[model samples]
Target chain A: MKISELSECSGVSIASIKFYQREELLPEPERTSPNQAQYDTQHVDRLRLIRALVDVGGLSVATVRTVLAAAESDIPMDWAMGVAQRAIPGSVELPATTTRGVSEIDTITETLGWKVSPDNPGRGMAARVIDSYVQLDHEEILSVLPEYSRAAMIVAAADLASVGLQPSRMRMSETVVVGTVLGDSLFAGLRRMAQEDEARRRYAQVQS
Target chain B: MKISELSECSGVSIASIKFYQREELLPEPERTSPNQAQYDTQHVDRLRLIRALVDVGGLSVATVRTVLAAAESDIPMDWAMGVAQRAIPGSVELPATTTRGVSEIDTITETLGWKVSPDNPGRGMAARVIDSYVQLDHEEILSVLPEYSRAAMIVAAADLASVGLQPSRMRMSETVVVGTVLGDSLFAGLRRMAQEDEARRRYAQVQS
Candidate 1:
């Protein structure tokens, strides 16, 4: 297939395909002549994955390259999961001085028996939000930490289950990366709809 | 309180406070002299909200201004909720030609008996994710839509409950805005931790 066909089939523009190739996110095609190159179905698939990661996942080119490399490795699923979680923007490393928020996250995870590592970027990410709540004097929101944790467990189980359903390790790796990134957007979108629904129910009762 | 005191009290830097003032996300303080102004506790509170929305929530300065204005209005909570939902980045308006994804989302929301409006940005946001799944040929992951939706409802209920706990309407409005923004990050971070725990449990068994 030609680059134009790759663009048409994968729904990514030819310019983006070239950009990804330059970024080393996509592999170079076999040269048919001085200027012509031939792509294949694998290129199409890779382009689709790259588009999903960049457009929907909002991952940077560097992170996407890292994730793609991890996904294509031998222990693809495990490596992809780690790479995807770490690639998540804003999952910063905790400053050594910030123990209070991290400790609160530890307490919650401990109560849940999650056994998550101390250095999991998620720990820092979650603690930062928790710290914001405390800083703003909205500590009451933390009261629902248990419920959020429980809900997270349910969704995580579903996430892993979905990954498990994939027929191949490669597919599993792709699912892990895509699900980790797009799943956040998916759940956030659904949560907004649910919030509107809940708000209407509660506020309607108040009016009635 | 002076600007410096406001920054100290709110934990936002003086420069950022000035930026917020320039953006009109924060109201002007009372001018005490040609070069000095007097800020009160309200300014401190406002700065905290602005920081939460920008830092934790990742909202843009323009959106923060809109959300703050809505939060300060008479029918604050309702307006704040609506504004915050719309302000969420990546909640693009669906093309009119696009009906399949939206209909799919409609089915899920309807099955859950959620009375969400068609125009709700969340509808478009979730639909776009669904469309991405289809485009990537990873539609199998949609098998967990129900589980994700269920978890979203759980978190949404907690969100509204936390907002309801606020003692004043203004505080309620602030909670709605902050919760709508930060809640997404909070849940995403926890979900990552949960995924790590689930992967460890599942894979550790395989290794054993």
Candidate 2:
């Protein structure tokens, strides 16, 4: 197949495909002639994965590059998934001096008996939420942390189980990255629906 | 206090506060002179909310404006939060003719007895994840939907309970908006940590 076919099949623009190639998100294809290059099934699959990361997963190109490299590495699936999870774009930066929020989050993780790295961006990311809540004088919001973590554990277990069912290492890595990134939106979307359900049930008596 | 003071107290940059002001994300402070405007505690609080939405919640200024307006409305908290959820940036646009994903999502929502509005962006957002998965020939990934939805219900219940703890209508509205936005990242971050723990446990045999 050619670039145009790849574009048509993947539904990604040629310019984006070129941009991805330049950004090293996609690999260079074989040149069939001075002006033509031939792409293969791998290119199609790679482009689809790239689109899934950027479009659905909302990962930055650099992060996607790093994730792709990790996927291609000989590292264990667990480590590859961890790398991809850390590379997620978390814009909420915590001040290095704020030990309280971090410690509070660690307490929840420890009580849950979950052993994650001290440097997992997830910890800092979760801590940022607590910090925001505290900043607003709504520290009581932390009361919900345990429940959220329990629910998170359930979802995470199911996520890993799904990844475990994949047929190949490459597919597992792709699922890990996509599931981590887009799964947020998926679960958030479901949460909205669930909230609507719960809110309706709670308000029915008031309305009645 | 002035804009500078509000910025100083909130730790948000003056330029961003100005940008939010210009974007109508924040209401105008009272002008005491031709060149000087005085802000108050409300300004500080509002600035923090704006920063939380933009920085941590990853909402667009336009969406923030809509959400702020929703927050100020006399509408029920449920409706206001719905508006905010619908205004979130879901960049993965599906073709207008694409009904398969929407109906597939509807099936899940129906099965769960959720009563969300047809136009709820959460529906579309989650549908986009499904569409991406199907596009990549990983439809089996939907196997995790039930688990994710079940977990989402737990978190949503906690989320609403936290909001119910608020003391005033205004504070309730604020919590609704903040929780809806920041809560996504918070859960996602925790999910990552939870995933690490679960993966560690599952892969322990391989590592050992």
Candidate 3:
């Protein structure tokens, strides 16, 4: 396929594809002639993955570049996943950096006996969420943390298992990178649908 | 309190606070005299909410403005929540307008008896996610939708319960708006932490 076909297939503009090439996000194509380049299935796959990460996953270009590098490398799946996960943006700041919040997350993780690295951004991200709830004087919302974590565990188990089932190393790598990013949105959307269902079930009786 | 004190307390820059005020994201502070405006605890609270929605929720200024308006309105909690949830961005694009994807989502929601409106962005968002996985030829990933929806129901049950526990109409409305927005990030962050834990547990013995 030519670059035009790749652009058409991926729904990415030709200029943007060229820009991704300039940014080293996409690999150089094979030159069939002095003025023509030929792309293959792999190029189309990579472009789609990049579009998912940038457009849907809302990852920054630099972050997308790092993720692409990880996807292409022959690194272990777990290692590649770690790199991709770390590149994700974390939460913004809050007033009074609360040691209490950190300690609370520590308690939950310890109680669950889940061996996560001390440096995982999820730790800080979760803590910041707690802080946000606290700042709003809505600390009662944190009571749902245990339930949320349990749901997370279930979803995570499925996610991890899906990555393991991929047929190829490249597929596995793509799943780890693109899957982890877009999975957030996927679950979020589903969660909202489920929430609406549950809300109507519980409240429809009372409201009527 | 003075604007400077509000800025210091909220950790928002004076200019940004002024910007929010102009944007009607924050209600105008009472003018003490021609040269000065006096802010109170309400200003601080609203500022923190604005920051949470903008910084953590990743909402646009325009979306945040609508959300703030919802928070101030005497509308029902569910109505306010609907506004906030609808304002959230969804997936970018997918190949071929698949009526199949829409019907698939409709089937799932119908089976669950979830009374989601036709216009809910979650409906399309969820469909687009499925489409992305299909485009990548990883439709197997969609197999977990049932599990994900189950988890979402549990979380949503807790979320609605929490809103019901709020002490005032204003607080409930605020939670409906702000919670619906930031809750996505809150859950995403927690899901990552939970995922790390689960992955380590499942794969640790294999690797180590």
Model 3 interface RMSD over true interface Cα atoms:
2.1
Instruction: Tell me the TM-score for chain B of model 1.
Output: 0.80
**Please, what are the lDDT tens digits per residue for candidate 1 over residues A52-126?**
777666788888878777767766355457776777665667857756678888898888888776778778878
Candidate 1 chain A least-lDDT 10 residues: A71-80
Q: How many Å off is the CA of B117 in candidate 3?
A: 1.6
Query: lDDT score, residue A205, model 2?
Result: 35
Which lDDT tens digits does candidate 1 get at residues B1-208?
9988888888888998888788777789999899999999889777776776776567888887777667667663555577766766667687587565787888999899997867787887888888888878888889889999999999989998998888876577668767777778788889989999888877653542
Residue B13 in model 2: lDDT: 82
Between which residue pairs do clashes occur in model 2? none
Give the count of colliding residue pairs in each prediction.
0, 0, 0
Candidate 3 Cα misplacement greater than 4 A, ranges: A1-75, A89-98, A205-208, B1-77, B87-98, B205-208
Candidate 3 to native Cα RMSD, angstroms:
5.2
TM-score to native of every candidate shown: 0.80, 0.77, 0.75
Q: In candidate 2, what are the lDDT values of residues B21-109, reduced to their tens digit?
A: 88777779899998999988888877776766676567878777777777787787677766765665653454486565677788989
lDDT of 3: 0.74
C-alpha local distance difference test of each model: 0.80, 0.80, 0.74
